[model samples]
Target: MKQKRFGIDIDGTVTCPTSLIPFINKDFSLNITLDDIKKYDLSEALDIPAERCQDWFNEREPDIYWSSPLAEGAKDVLLKWKEQFQLFFISARRSHLLDLTQKWFETKDILYDRIELIGSHDKIKAAKQHKVDIFFEDKHDNAVSIHEELRIPVLLFNTPYNQDPVPSGVIRVDNWAQAEQWVKAWIDSESFIQQ
Candidate 1:
């Protein structure tokens, strides 16, 4: 069984999708559940003015990043994957947040081969540069692009924000458990094909 390189996204992929809801509810004094988040931008989904959202984000982004809870089963599955795959995290978070990201990874005891905070959701270049055999993503567009451009498999963690359609190579998974199973299947089929 040869090792593979996997490109993963942060935010809703590795962190719980509802991680920001509590903070938003606290800040806005509005009770909104994870179900209310239909778009990737909180401003758009919450109906908050973009400038206000930007200001709020600028003020609280660090705290938000620091306090984000890991996705269910993410640590366990990732720890297992670490032994057989090179984990490369490609996040849209600003490059300056590397320290916070690394600290969070340490706290969660998740190891990775590399982490890229590209300050944008466009991840095709990074995925290509890393030569990832597969990608795990939460963004609908990014997932579609990575798969279509790279001609590789992508496990898209399902979220309300990314409910758009995807191509054949993009698989929608609800949790890390499904992601693990899908990856295992891909690897098994890949091995069979290679032989």
Candidate 2:
């Protein structure tokens, strides 16, 4: 049997984007807490026209993705999963971060088949093009959209701002350990039945 294909997100899923928040807060310097950073509506804080904010985000793309640190166990879990599935990173971290993100993966020695860095808020189209079977993501809106449209099973990685209730059929997991076990059990059960 062929191995399943997984579409994984970068920020807040495989890695924590906390570093970017500090940058954003320092640039704004509103004495914001981490929670405030997480809960902040970028549109409101930036207080700019939509197109201008888009431009600003594009300009600051590097500061966001490259500064993040990988989540705990993300490297190990991904390495283990590489043995059972084809891993593809489907991130909304802009095209500029392609080289940086790839270098980050190389440093971690993560063996993924592909890495896609789409612009922010355009993951669903990218995932559809990739034919991703399952996805692990941390963004609530993205998860809901992907799950609703593609009906793909998404393992939601818990995050402060993403604590909104997940729709039915979407699995919510606290950490990568639980995610690894869930995938392993499913694969093992399939193997057993085939035997």
Candidate 3:
């Protein structure tokens, strides 16, 4: 069977972002918790423009793109998937973080065909442009938007902040190991059998 294209997210989905939370709270002094950051509605922070929040992050942790830790089994699962799919990283990390993100990939030895750093909140447009059949993301808003607008399958990697209600047709998985199995099973099922 022919390989499929996979569009994956960077933050919590690929690399764990927990390590950066402390820096975010310390630098911003917003009394924000990890949950607050995860479910943050940038529009609601009237005192800070959404874009300025990105700047705040850059100022405090310029190397966040490279410093974020990988989730357990992330490297192994991704490397395995790379052999079977055209892996493309679709991240909301600011475009300026590209160099650091690349450095992280190099450090972990994670291979990919392409990496697209989408700084804006809007991810549906990027998914449509890429013709991504399946997306693995941690953000509820992004998953909802992409799945609804493009009718593409989105596997929402579970997180504390996103534990509430989920949009229709979006599947949630606990971790990368389970996610990898779910994806492989779906691809191997008789329903997807090729002629």
Candidate 4:
């Protein structure tokens, strides 16, 4: 059997979606929780200007990424999958953060076959280049887009900000445990089809 390659997003998928909330609240002096973020744009959620939010993010991106915690159940599942599947981390983080990203992964004890930091939300190109059998993402449009474009299933990690409706190919998983269940079923069905 050929090993499946999974294209996964870093932030909000592997890391907790609310990883930046405390930082945002502290920096902005507003006690807003993850549920308060209705939109993917932090500025919109905070009702602040976009540029100001961008500036803050740029200044604190390293610290934020360095300290972000893994999502619940992510470590166990990913570690198990590492022995069978080819894990490729495709993130919207900039290329300059490769060292920091690798360090973060090491600190978290996560293993990967590859990591691509594309610096933009549009991940279709990277997904295609990696030839991933499936994808995992936290962004709503990104999940829909990667599935629609690549003709592959995309597991969307559910978040308050990504409550928008998704296509049939985009499976919504509330946590890594659910994600593991879905992947097992998908692999079984695919194997059956091949046979």
Candidate 5:
């Protein structure tokens, strides 16, 4: 049987949702938490001009990604799944960040079968090209669109910024632990069906 592939987003999914909070708070000199991020736009959350926020992010993107922390329980679950599934990480990060991203993964002691830096939020093309059985993401629109377009299950890691309602195929999970539970059950069902 062919190995099932898992398409996962890198940042804000495997990495803690609050990973960028420190940078934002320090650079902008504001006291904010993850709860302050009610939307995906950092500018909107910080009440700053979008252009200024974008400039700041562009300048500090590398440092931000390099210093990101892994989400709790993500390492264990991902490592365990590494034995059973193809871990295909699909990220919105630019292609130039490949080296940095790989180094970051190594620094975190995480393993991946493949990593695709698509530089855009629209991941439908890459996901379809890779033929992933399921997807994991923290972006609300990305999760909903991927599931709806691909007709596959998508686990949306719940966060303050992505509180939007998801479609039926988009399963909202609180953390990596909950995500693993859902994936395990799904895998078992798939095995039974294949058998």
Candidate 6:
């Protein structure tokens, strides 16, 4: 089988979706559970002004990223797929944090083919530039846009915030285990189609 280039997102996809909840609750002094986060932008759910939210995020971004716990099964499955797939991490994080990102990966002992931090959630261009055949994402709009713009399948990790309608190409995965199974199925189906 040919090696496939895969696009993966960080933050809520690689890291547990609720990883930042504790920080938010303590910092804002508001008791909100992960279930209360219905929007990817916390400002919308928290009823905080966008500017204030952005300012707070800017100040606490590094700490949030550094302290996030990995999503269940993310490391093991990614490790197993490392040799078979070109694993590219494409995040909305600022590129300046490349050192931190790399350090975290090193600390986790994970391997990757490439890591791109574009400082924006709009990743269709980056995905196209990388020529990725498949994408793993957690943002609803990002997943939809990437799937529509690139015409490639996207495995959107299911989270409370991203429970939106998706087209046929956008597959929802509850965890990395389901992600692995979906990728295997997709590859098998694609192979059959090509033949």
lDDT scores of the candidates, listed in order:
0.92, 0.78, 0.78, 0.95, 0.94, 0.92
Q: For model 3, where is the 10-residue window of minimal lDDT? A: 37-46
lDDT of 1 by residue, 1-195 (tens): 557999999898898988888889999999889888999888999999999999998898899989999999999999999998899999999999999999999999999999999998889999999999999998889899899999999999998899988888999999999999998898889999999
Query: In angstroms, how far off is 89's CA in candidate 3?
Result: 0.3
Worst 10 residues of 5 by lDDT: 39-48
Q: Rank the candidates by TM-score, best first.
A: 4, 5, 1, 6, 3, 2
Candidate 2 lDDT tens digits, 1-195? 777889998878888646566766666565655465444356554564667656766787776766667888888899888987889899877686789889888877888999998877668888888888888988788888889999988888876667777788678888999999988887788789989
Candidate 4: tens digits of C-alpha lDDT, residues 89-126:
99999999999999999999999999999999999999
1 against 2, candidate with superior lDDT? 1
Q: In lDDT terms, how accurate is model 3?
A: 0.78
- For residue 161, model 5's alpha carbon misses the true position, in angstroms, by 0.8
Worst 10 residues of 1 by lDDT: 1-10
* Candidate 4, position 154, lDDT: 97
Model 6: residues with Cα > 4 Å off, grouped in runs: none
Per-residue alpha-carbon lDDT of candidate 5 for residues 1-195, written as tens digits (9 for 90 to 100): 689999999999999989899998899998989998999988887789999999999999999999999999999999999998999999999999999999999999899999999999999999999999999999999999999999999999988989988889999999999999999899889889999
Ranked candidates, highest lDDT first: 4, 5, 1, 6, 2, 3
Best prediction by TM-score:
4
Candidate 3 lDDT over residue span 12-93, tens digit each = 8888847666666666675665556545454343256778875776675556656778988899999998987888899877
Query: Candidate 3 — which pairs collide?
Result: none
Of 3 and 6, the candidate ranking higher by TM-score: 6
Q: How do the residues 99-188 of candidate 6 rate in per-residue lDDT, one tens digit apiece?
A: 999999989888999999999999988999999999999999999999999999999998889998999999998999999999888888
Best by lDDT: 4
lDDT of 1 at 41: 84
Question: Which 10 successive residues of model 4 have the least lDDT summed?
Answer: 39-48
